[model samples]
Target: MHSVCVLGLGLIGGSVLRAVRSAGYPAWGATKSEGDRDAALADGYDVEASVEDALRRAADEDALIVLAVPLTALEEVLRQIRALAPSCPLTDVVSVKGPVAEAVGRILPSVRYVGGHPMAGSTESGWAAGSAELFRGAPWVVTAEEETDLTRWAQVARLAIACGAHVIPATPEQHDATVARISHLPHLFAAVLAAVGAEGGPLAWSLAAGSFTDGTRVAGTRPELVRAMCEGNRSALLEALDEALGRLGAARGSLASTGGLAVTVDAGHEARRGFTATPQAGPAEIRIDLKDPNALDELLDLGTLGGRITSIEDDLAVGEELGNP
Candidate 1:
């Protein structure tokens, strides 16, 4: 097992450190927050005095460096990594992939970099709210661009698997576009829904039930964190936002003119059913040989088809296609 060093020990980063260490891989982390540092240290985990110290140690030990920082903090963190451990194998658990990939390319081009985003989180933030099991059974995307370093990709995928997530290979652009709809858009919707519900005042609050609670659950996430994620993928989010607005506008028009919402309601119900059904359906097995020249292409195609890698053996990746019936 490759040793791991994580920067930004809050939430996702803290969870990664806990899970990675629990998996029997030597792991250590660093955080700028004194509270988080003290908390993690009190919990018996190894935490360096500073990011520089952690990076220096990672360089000496040839550890895999995981960037768990927010997108707004990414550039500064990348610069620190470039100065302290320029050649270290690098990966990230940031929400947005495209911007992070671009930053890595520009700032640390010589590093063995593989972008990653684990689709798991809580409305809560900080080290205290993190759990080792946070990513269990989640879809962890590993960016598989044409020029990606397959070896480094495999290492990052292995770490994600160790943290109990299935690896989904995708290009950074694909990851960003997909997440803009599924993750970022939902956060925006949740915020809007929560605000609308609150506008109903005390009566609405008293009458609120499962639907309202579930719909606005992510609204509880830290505002700055949500802002960072949504803003970081501005281009993709704008596209998703436009489509959502169009749908909502059509629904509003129908409600005004016909006094019915059958079209919008039925479409949404069916889509929700489909979303629920996909994971329950049995998956078909898929295998790809890493030695093949087109292996990366095959992996990305599989991901587009909703495939996920369960494990890698030698040069062969064993996975399952979950999208197709």
Candidate 2:
């Protein structure tokens, strides 16, 4: 935890560098290019550009090592680090844990590795996108395993806390499942919906206002990044997609019936009223469906829920009654 080597000086990696420095830990970074090195050093990050220099500064087996690269590059980096700094407690910020962790155990059996994913980041990149507060109050998921060293795991948790993140521990399988529902599937649906809306070109899009903007905003980020996350967590993502498609199909069915849509809307309203809290400071209020477990967490950032709350008329929650249909 003294000196840390952060691989990939992109948005999330650079942010971790900033967080490490802020936490009073000596931090260094590895980047493939000189420009990224210059950017990290120039940002006053306790970050050195070269892995050798970074490792020297942090000094081996004691420092934490974070792989901030994409999931695809995880194995290569893991093998490299295993040779370079074998004793360091390694972790990654990759969105999908299953693939990365499995790859690590299979490819580099000697290294002590734990899978990590911080549910925070901006669409922006490079050194300038780094933020010490990027992880503040964000859910930093740590994947738990039976063979995991508890003491080493604590070191990882310390970093999460130091970064201002709220820590949540889970098995890699459960972590993947939860993230598929909360993160991946949403991005997939959003991208598809945005693509549909873009079909008519400028005229079709010009009519899209705030609602459209808010709905598909995430689709604007790097598509490959989204795809990598989903593909890496394919098993969980597939299960989540199956469940989500069922909801859509059921909604379509309800819409086709006389007053069925109203029934569905009413049910949403009723369930929302019980679970969601009212806004504390908004002058105007609106109700929104809040069956999603992450709704409240998201609402904390949103200025208001638009007074949007609802109750299920039949006392039924769509995904609740039928599991993946």
Candidate 3:
């Protein structure tokens, strides 16, 4: 694509806009706030005055218009894009895909929109949080419908490649359901753990250990961000919650067995050992989202480049818990 419009110059949107520029595609963004517009411009991301302005500016250009806004704002963006003429392609970076695709279908018959989720983010946000390399080596998920424009889809794939991201294709519903388990559910569980620890006051915090810290890491996510994600994917989140509860029930059953705590301890030990196996080229590239760039860079420099079909050795032979979608 020659040019693209990125709506909502926040973290994910700004990052993609920046990456598009780095990939040599002329890029521009739309934002509601003057401060955001200025910030994104200062960060070297082209800023457009409004959505209509962005679409008009990108008119007749082989460009992609992206709505990087929250899931809550998706419907409005889709409506506006639907009203636009059918020259340029439209896409989105909303975390949940199912609702976004459904909404777009209802309103935009000829508007070619694709759903995407960059499996990367930071604790930070807003236009001031823009970065071109923010998505380097991250998983760039694209979910397309049967009517999706193949040429536009290929352009998006190329964009992902330029950003050093691995491409994973799925349907909108599949993307939503999978993210409910891996992304949304984890956030919920982490917050739950944090609240439990804080329940006992400062003393409880003092007693928290490594496991607690790692397990509850996502609990530190920004409130608005978490609220948006959970609410947007409520249906899948509910299903994820049921599955998590079922796993918890199984663990409880084990703990309540004749051996009780001993069985639990053994199970925990086994779980811990899985991560201890000699670092093998995993059977698959561990496509992970990094809230911190430095952290991901360190791993990459350590020779953990993602996208390999599998690890050099078959670590799965030892029966590690498989991470499902």
Q: Could you tell which candidate, 2 or 3, scores higher by lDDT?
A: 2
How are the candidates ranked when ordered by TM-score, highest leading? 1, 3, 2
Say what the RMSD of model 1 is: 1.8
lDDT of 3: 0.70
Model 1 error, position 256 (Å)? 2.7
Cα RMSD for candidates in order: 1.8, 10.8, 8.8
For residues 54-169, what per-residue lDDT tens digits would candidate 2 score against the true structure?
Answer: 65544444778888987777777766666666777788898888888888888778777877788898887777877989988777776656666554555675677778875566
Q: What's the C-alpha lDDT at position 128 in model 2?
A: 82
Off by over 4 Å in 2: 46-49, 52-61, 200-203, 257-259, 262-275, 278-325
Error of 1 at 232 (Å): 1.9
- TM-score, cand. 1: 0.94
lDDT of each candidate versus the true structure: 0.92, 0.70, 0.70
Residue 252 lDDT in model 3?
Answer: 84
Backbone clash total for model 2 is 19
Put down candidate 3 lDDT per residue, 231-305, tens digits, no spaces.
899899999899779768877887777536665567668866864654554343343222233422322232222
Q: What's the residue-level lDDT of 20 in candidate 3?
A: 82
Model 3 pairs in collision: 281-311, 281-312, 282-311, 283-310, 283-311, 284-310
Greater-TM-score candidate between 1 and 2: 1
